[model samples]
Target: MKTRMLKIEGPRKLVLVEKELVLEDDEVLVRTLQSSICGTDKMYYRGEMPPNEKYPLFIGHEGGGVVEAVGSKVDEYQAGDLVMSFSRSCTFADYFKTKPINLQPVPEGLDMRIAALGEPLACAMHSVLESGVQLGDTVAVMGMGFAGQIMLQGARKKGATKIIAIDVLEDKLKLAKKMGADVTINPAKENLYQTIMGLTNGQGVDVVFEAAGNQDSLNACSAILKHNGHLVLYSWLTQPVTLNMHRWHQNSFKIITTTLVHHTKYERIVWSEKAMRPFQQGLIDVEPLISAEYKLADIKEAFEESVNNDEIIKIIIKP
Candidate 1:
């Protein structure tokens, strides 16, 4: 069948192009409903991600849709089931094929639009767990983008006290506050180290999350971590960045790197179901963070707007 798909035909250029999809024997063809933009998508759009994705590659990984057709081997879902999927579903298209292992049936009464965001929330959940945040622990999260904001929420749910949110954008800081961040900081306008020290009684935070994906943010993550504290690196820095290992070594800091793609499909699904349950129940609301939505054909414009507008957080593309 013919469908519209986002094609990365060249560096920094994404265009909606018609494509034909053929389902293999083990795959299920899904009619794309809603696909969300991620921070990694932004980095790929700007040609920063390494290993150089081949030209004309489809560009979406997080989304939900209906089962259009099931392969002969697929028995878990019928043709009309509603499902959410992650990691290489290529959901930019109106209809795409994925393995049954990748698609999870959305629980009853859950909004597919928000459920499309399960992947990011799950990754944030993993990072938060890896950070080893304890109740009453002081935690500082750098960056308030989609993933970072969710990470802050995860920290709050982990019983973190004195949760510090840092970003250069004032609007994001406001969103961070809405997401239950105890304190927000704009490093451009304030000193992150001083504010974090002051908030934690000069010992720095018990844990720090580096979600901003930059050298400066990594440095701040190291500086803000207390002795024997945990530093969770959740960002994917596309370029090679330097770090001062002396501080980490001397302070006995523990650095942890976690990625959603590295996780097994079963692991991802279990954690996603648990982490996204709060959002599904309206307890953890991310409505304030979804700044824009666009149809599949207008995704290029959506990406451009997201890059140009500092106030924009998460942008969703509906097919």
Candidate 2:
């Protein structure tokens, strides 16, 4: 069968074209309902991604859909089952196939639209879980983008008493406040180091998440981390960026790199469900992050608008 999918022809150029869909013995075919534009997708679109791909590569990695067909080798899901898939490839299409291990069954009452976000949410949950964020800790998220916002929410759920959200945009800062950030700072307007120090009584935050993929954030991450604090680098820096190791060495901070793709297949399946449970209960809402939506045919326009609009948190495409 033929499926319509989004392809990245080159930097800043996206095309929606029909492609052949081949079924694999161990794969289950999914009719994509909703797929959202992720930070990695934006990086690949703008030529900022370090990991290169062949031309016309399938672009999306976050989405949820219904099972259209079940392979003979698959038994975890059947046709017509509502499901979400992550850390897999070729998600931006009317139909895509995945191994049973990568698919997570969506709870009966969950919203499928937000279930599409399971990948990003799972990454945030992993970071929070690994960071060892505990009750009464002071946490600071260095960005207000999708993953950063979700991590801030996760930090709150982990029992943080003081949560500081940092971003360059005023609108995102407003959204951070709504998402339970006790403090929000625009690095452009206020000194990020000063704000973190002030919020933590000059001791710095117990946990600092570096979501901005730049050297400035890298340097500031160490500065804001308290002695023996945990620092999670959540953003993928495609380019070579310098880091100040002096503070890291002096403070003995535990710096860990967080990535959803690096998790084992079994770990992803476990966390994907744990991550989506709150959203399933309507406790952690994702409605504020969805800034725009488009049909598969208009994905090029959607990508262009999302790039120009820095205020956009997430954009979903319907197939």
Candidate 3:
């Protein structure tokens, strides 16, 4: 079958091309219901990705869809089954072919829009779980993007008494407050270190999550973490940054990297299923984070808006 796919040809260039899809026996074909642009996708669109991961890349991995066809060996999925796919199989297309291992069956009662965000939500859940946030512990999430916003709710669920959401954008901080942050800090105007120290009585937070993927955010996260505190690294930093090892060594900080996508196939299946429970039970609210939606034909404009607009949290592509 022929499919319309979006390919990132170069910086600020998105080309929609038609191609024939040949599904192998181990693969399944999906008709995309909704696909959302991720932070990594924006990096690729802006040509800021690493040298090895260059464009003309097939961007986008966060998507949920109905199975349109299944291969002979794919017994678990059939046509019309709702599935959330976690792969770079070019989800910004009318249809995509992927193996069953990269797909998860959407649980009953979960909205498809939220289901499309399974990849990121799962990553946030993994980060929160691995951070080992204790009851009544003070937690701060640096960066109020989709991941940080989701992690704020996760920290709240894990029994954080004081959940501080930090970001440069007031809109994101406002949404974070609405989503259940105990305090919101805009570092652009306010001093992050003073505000956090004051809130914690100069003891600093017990756990700090760095999801902003910037050098300054990382440095700030390290600065405010308490002695022997857990510094959860959730962002995918495409570039290298110098760190202040003096503070980290003096405080004896424990760093935890939660890259969920690197988990084994079986492990990922189990983790994704377990991680999605909070969303099903209303513990995490992703609806407010979806800031905009655009047609697949307007992908160029969508990419530009996603990069230029600070108020935009998450953008969905309806093919």
Candidate 4:
């Protein structure tokens, strides 16, 4: 069958191209349902990523679809199964071929639109788990994007008594409050260090999550981390940023880098399954995070919105 897929020809340029599907023995063909734009996708769209030029590069990974066809050797999934995929199969398309192992069945009754966020949700959950948040611990999430929102909720679920959300955008700060952040901080207007110190009684928080992926946020995180505090790094920074290493060295901080996607396939499989339980139980709220949706044909406009709009937490593409 022929599929129409989005291809990136240059920075901020996208074209819909047709291609015939070729199924491998261990692969399955998925008819796309929902695909979402990620922060990395924005970087690629802006020509910030230095990985490869190779114009017409395939760009989406967070998506869900129904299996339309299965290879002869694919026994675990069939033609009608609803599945979430985490691979570079260029999911911004009507149909794509993927290995069965890269697909996870959406839980019964779960909305496929929300389930398409499995990849990012799992990564956020993994970071929360690795942070080792203890009961009644004071926690702070720096940045109120999708991952930050999810991380704060996960911290709350893990027994954080006082969860602080920090961001410059008032819209994100408001959403953070709605998502159960005990306190919200706007660093642009208030002194972030003084605010966090006052909130924590001058001791700082037990765990500080740096999700903003910038030098300013990193410095702010360092300023408010208590002695021996755990600093959880959750963002993917494409460029290098200056760090306050003196503070880290003096306070003996424990830095935990929780980039779950970098884990081995077997490890990710185990962790992703465990990470999804909270979502399955309805504890992790993702519905409010989906800020916008666009049809596949309007992908160019969708990319423009994602790049220019600061309030958009997530954008879903439906084909």
**lDDT agreement with native, every candidate:** 0.83, 0.83, 0.90, 0.89
For all the candidates, what are their Cα RMSDs to the real structure? 1.6, 1.6, 1.3, 1.5
lDDT for each residue of candidate 3 in 120-197, tens digit (9 for 90 to 100) = 888888898899999999999999999998899899989999999999999889899899999999999999999999
Badly placed stretches (over 4 Å) of model 1 are none
lDDT string for model 1 (80-162, tens) is 99888777788888988889888778867888777777677667767876678899989888898987887788788888978
- Candidate 1 weakest ten by summed lDDT: 48-57
lDDT of each residue in 240-260, candidate 2, tens digit only: 978888978887988887775
**Can you tell me which runs of candidate 4 are displaced by over 4 Å?**
51-54
- Model 1 misses residue 310 by how many Å? 0.7
Span of 10 residues, lowest total lDDT, candidate 4 = 47-56
Ordered by lDDT, highest first, the candidates read 3, 4, 2, 1
Listed in order, each prediction's TM-score against the native is 0.94, 0.95, 0.97, 0.95
Candidates ranked, most accurate by TM-score first: 3, 4, 2, 1
Off by over 4 Å in 3: none
Higher-ranked by lDDT: 3 or 4: 3
Which has the higher TM-score value, candidate number 2 or candidate number 4? 4
Error of 2 at 78 (Å): 1.2
**Candidate 1 lDDT score at position 193:** 86
> Candidate 3 at 36: error in angstroms?
0.4
**What would the TM-score be for candidate 2 when compared with the true structure?**
0.95
